[model samples]
Target: MALRISKKYIHPPVSFLNNHFQFLEISEKITRSKIQSLLDEAYESRINNLSRSIGLAEEALSLSKESADKSFIGKSLSHLSLFHMIIGDFDLSINMANEAIENFEDLDDAKGIADAKYTIAGALYKTNDFSKGLTHLIDCLATYKKLEDYHNLARVQKSIGTIYEFFGDIKSATQSYEEAIDSGKKAGDLNLQSNAFNPLSGLYLNQNKIPKALAIIEESIVIKEKTEDIRGLAFALYGRGKVYTQTKQFEQAEQDFLQSIKIHEEMGEKLGWAMSHHKLGALYIKMNRLEEAREILVRALEYSNKNKIILIKFKANLLLHEIAKKEKNYELALKYLTQYVEEKESVINDRTAKVIEGYDVISKMQALELEANAQREKADIIEKKKIELDSFFYRISHDLKGPITSLMSLNYVAKLEVKDEAALKFLSEYDAQANRLNNILDGLLRLTKMSFNEDSKQEIDFEKIIYDCIASYKFLANYELVEFKINIDSKIVYEAEWALVNTIIQNLIENGIKYARIEDGNKPYISISINQEGDVIKITATDNGIGMDEKTIDNIFVMFFRANRKIEGTGLGLHILKRAIERLNGEISAKSKLGEGTTFTVVLPK
Candidate 1:
């Protein structure tokens, strides 16, 4: 129910190398001129070498400026605008698009003007200026229609529908999406037609039209699969997963989510990876697989945090709070709760600003389009308030961190000064709780610090890291009986961060021993093996323990997830290991059966 159709299922509008953009017609003069070579190469390399494409466009711009050719200048600026937009430099994209539109207008270039306007609309959309974006899209739609450019006309219509969908204008959005689908079919572009089904499915699903939504999504998946569009297929699968989840068909949903994740990983789509992880993790939580939920959510959090994706981070944190509470670690639960609250408030404020900004833009555009100025001033005032509120929230959040740190330091000092035996014992308990709180705060601070830390990559003696991790486990009470079988080629050197690799191996090794089955009939043992294949180093750790089921394996790495509640732990060991592997630009996975054993595998680029 929470899911909606999205433009992300389609390739981003601003990426110039997309098939739709590449097919746009150019003027005869420009096509025949020397500048044509640069433009052609730019288009060809746009997908494979974006920076080079931009550089070529810049060269064309410089030449055009020297020649004082309005046509060349407009086309070059349009290219630059689209390239910038694709790279997420929305402000620069807007400026360049405006400049391109002006030059195109001077030359009476209708197609050029329309292209520039479309780029401007895309920039506005990226910045959450939805009202202005819709205005530009409408303008571009009219131009493309007049020129009989059905391909582009459908593209603009699809974009307009997406905005309307976001604005909750379902009727208008459905109309626009249908128009897009009709146009795409007329143009014989099944791919574009396939695009319509995604949003349509979402719209139907939101209205609880289950059968209709399923039919539409199935159609989308079939079409995309036939076309062999990897990303499209993945998106369709993910959408289907959402619908299945809502319908409480969890087994089917899990399969769909896993299939989508596999494709996303292959395509290197981090956003899709994060989205599916968040969805699947939430599903696990609902199924009461706390361990698996924790694992997947931690992964979701890492990817979301790395990308500054606030929504997923908020969801991940909220679930982590639940997991911590389920484990009876009230201190850790509160820690996650604090982060969830902060992130939730921040996201709410951000969304509020966008909504206000959208209204402000709409009011101003309406005033201009109708040749009235009465409401423009009021709109400007609203915009100003939104900006001010944004700054205030940011400052307040930063300032709040200081008092938390002070409280932690004061609590530590109180523990050190306590004198009476009874009081000392009570103080010791309080100190443990306070330290847990401090650890959570420290984690938040560490995220900020680690973001800026440069990768310290070098040739590492990985076998040493494994042995050292094994050595650290000797300190664990009653853990000496757990046998370790080391199968490592000491001569094999791996290129990675020493600290991260060490941390990953240490945490994983410690987890194997800590969770080992210690019953009379079972001799707990851990098998650590390391091997190199081409440019990758694969490490496997197998343990005979009270292993997890399929669902548990899915979430074993989640933060604060104690799979074996009988063991004493903070539930952070595997979580930390997973995070460390992420830092090393590697991957970690687990396979386990309840009461049998577990096997963890890590793959790192060498």
Candidate 2:
């Protein structure tokens, strides 16, 4: 005889339910509630959550094997991967994802395979192999597209956009995000679509395209509210707040950031709450509210550390450094600033560097092609000019040399003929002026040569460049008190144009020394530091000097950029440096505070 069900439709007693239920039906499928319960317990960590998750998964694996239900087996495999990810065993997660993928593939289950690939991509993303992660995600996206899995495709695109954003490629990032939004709308996935728009807006904000960013984010916020995805709404609002901060709309930024923090707390998204706090701190600092900034930033730093979000932690520290400086707290400022020094070092081996390297190679090929094109065009336009051009250069070289040599030779002759000290001084001045003119011509010649070089780039020692610049200029002694720091990762090396690298560093370092504040007329100072992350080296030259305003900054690297003609300059140091660095496909930027200091960073491909 079977046991009859005696309990009312309340929560059934465990023993009765277990005994009276048809075990086959109940165990064959899990309800949404049951899955959520397991996931929550697993996420919360039941001291032995790994063991519990594994146990349940293994039990389900056995059951599915007995039932010969491949679908259930695929679910069990996914569960194992989730547990692996939860335990921070990413290698195991990768293996489990692969296994799950194989199982799902065998079942010809596109949906199951999509999920598995996403898990694989997530693991890859965590390990900092963002490119590989992005590849797997794109594969997942293609599968979703075939299965009409618009929702999941949107999710994948959002993440891919994030990787692009991280590398500072706003164009690619925005394109990915817009595709996500379109896909999400088609699938009625407002939450995911809103999520995509929010981050995309932040990217536009960084580019100073305020109107575009604001409009998109506002629409996203509206969608989030309509969908009632409270956490999604919070992040969207928070992202908008970040945009406002960038635009210096401080009041709105603070309110939005605080509102986001409140919502994040209510939703139990602690990491999001942490990021909001840090962003709020940045706003406070901008408003000259240092105390609030410091407190909030500290709270953020603690939370970010626990979550393993180093990017937020580093940025928070950078802001805190600024706040401390405002309070005349140099020690704390220095400490906080040092935290980012390591992370800035980690910018090596990223996708951006790889892309830049690839771009360099492609550009070389393109340049060759362009040269051919230009030659063909020139031949067509000026068939008779080659003889004339050659004759002109020959005449000019010979023509210019006569006067230059005569002037220099007369200066030397005068020195030998002069008997009085006054005549000797006059000859010395003439020689100096003539030599300066020759140096200018030499520089122009080198510049012209750089425009058409076909030589293969080779590795050069950065350490040697630093030392030679110092010894050749005797800049250290010229400065009364200088702070010089060189932090090079000994193994950091690059395949680049050697002569150009030397010239760039020489010009940049010379500028740093010249512009830096000296204790007295006899004092000059400069500091240099180098650090490595994966394959790139970051070189920084910092100094206590009078820094330029935004107007001057806007044109610092433009051709013939002169901030003050009263100050002796060719208006070409940074301009020439930019051209040389660009030839190597390198990036250089300056960060400065008026009457505070300046630091220039150069990122070269390795």
Candidate 3:
């Protein structure tokens, strides 16, 4: 049995983990006092080497039992439960967790009991024993709340919310999410806050609250990026992608799904990967990219089936059925449809969302109406708060940019005037800091401006725009050494919001030049291509620079995100580009591997 503990939800960073051989070397000299410590260390190995971790855990358990060390025995059982959960062994994990809970209960250890319950609930949730899982989770929540362990409380609330969402109880789910956000804020846990934000954003999206959903998801993405929570970020990005899909923003939807899938694959999170693939396939199908859709749907189906992820499998099969039907493959279509129907029915029956038809509901109409109004009022407050923050950013950015620019100019002049080497150096350093600050402010202005602009489509010279974008980047370092390849169809005439298009092209071109792995033996070059495809203009920017890993690529467009810490960047370039693309009703997607390089494709309405 694969005991899979989802890094998407339950991630306790193993700060104490090191090479397994180091622990093995130390264990040879271990005393009875070191037995429990060794067992604890064994659990940490699950992140690096699960099989060895499990073996060490089993050895420790046996040693503890032989030594008659009840404490070590209990801890080893608890540790084993978590390891099992991580490897997708739900039954064994649940059994071990329960046993650990009993032992902790006997010893009157509240924290230990809570930890065991948390693991048990997680395993039970994965096993589809929702009612029982909820019971354990509620108990865990109560214990955490009583202990004022806000982080764990937030985690439990998020888990509970997920269950309620699964059960189709939106009201309960919303309440749980709200509680989770509150608790996470109190705990200062960005991971919990971001995790809670994902489901909550989905709930809002389901209700057709697009702005609210985007706001919530954007906030979640920011927090996830800050915490470097790749799984959490992927989940949040998927939620945003869903919102984009709902609004018929296919381009943005495709980009989000692709980035999310890349991150999920890199993290080895099967569920996220399957779901993202499923979504991307659906998007491709909607876009009439039948072959691509079919290919992705197959991957989604295979992974979901192997992992026993029912919902993702059901969705993938449904899309596959559609693709087969579209291709006029009746037999294949029928087969896919049948499988989809079976999975759907199985899921529906298993979930069996509880619904009540009661006459008393009519009598409570007046109170229900009041509650609705109150909820709307609360929503309005949230909207207003977001607006205020946006306004603050816009105003502060505008106000600061002027003074900063002036200061930079003054510093530059001071450097020129200063004769002493020390004074000149100090001025240059001050000037550099000022320039950095000015760049940040400029990025903020660009971000805030994104919301202010409306679609102002005009005749766009496709070739000229690309040329201008590239020209602006020529002043940057290595511009002369780096080769520029332009492949624009000279006859192509596109119409778009010129400012937004310009921003998008400029940032992308600049980033390709800025982050290119220049030191590497590979010749640094940027490939720019633009062509008209019916009513759309396809533009691609390919770079032979230092490429990004999936994790870094997922966050490359996030505000203040920088993939390579060794490189200097405002992190605002890609973010501003995304905002610009969104404003222009265009889509931007990227593909990259660690060393190969990056390719960004932009599709805009013509």
- TM-score: which candidate is best? 3
Write one digit per residue (lDDT tens) for candidate 1, span 1-606: 697779776656566566555554344355437676897788556533567889999998888887777888888999988877765566788899999989988888889999988888877764446767877887787688779888777778888887777677799789988998998888887767877888888899999999999998999899888876666677789889889988999999999999999877765555568878988998887788889999999988987777555667888999899999989999999999999999889766766666676656556755665653457667888868845654554455356568767876876787778778998787777777766655554443333333345667888887667777777778886578788898987668767767777777777787788878888689999998999878888899999988898777777777667777776676666766776787778898888888888899999887
Clashing pairs in 1: 291-555, 292-555, 294-558, 295-558
What does the lDDT come to for candidate 3? 0.80
Q: How do the predictions measure up, each by TM-score?
A: 0.46, 0.47, 0.49
Quantify how close model 3 is to the true structure by its C-alpha RMSD in Å.
30.1
Model 3 Cα lDDT, one tens digit per residue, 6-85: 88557444643455656855764474656766776675554345566778888888888876666667788988887777
Give the Cα error of residue 199 in candidate 2, in Å.
Answer: 1.6
The predictions' CA RMSDs to the true structure, in order, are 32.6, 29.3, 30.1
Better of 1 and 2 by lDDT: 1
Tell me the deviation in Å of residue 104 in model 2. 2.5
lDDT of 1 at 39: 78
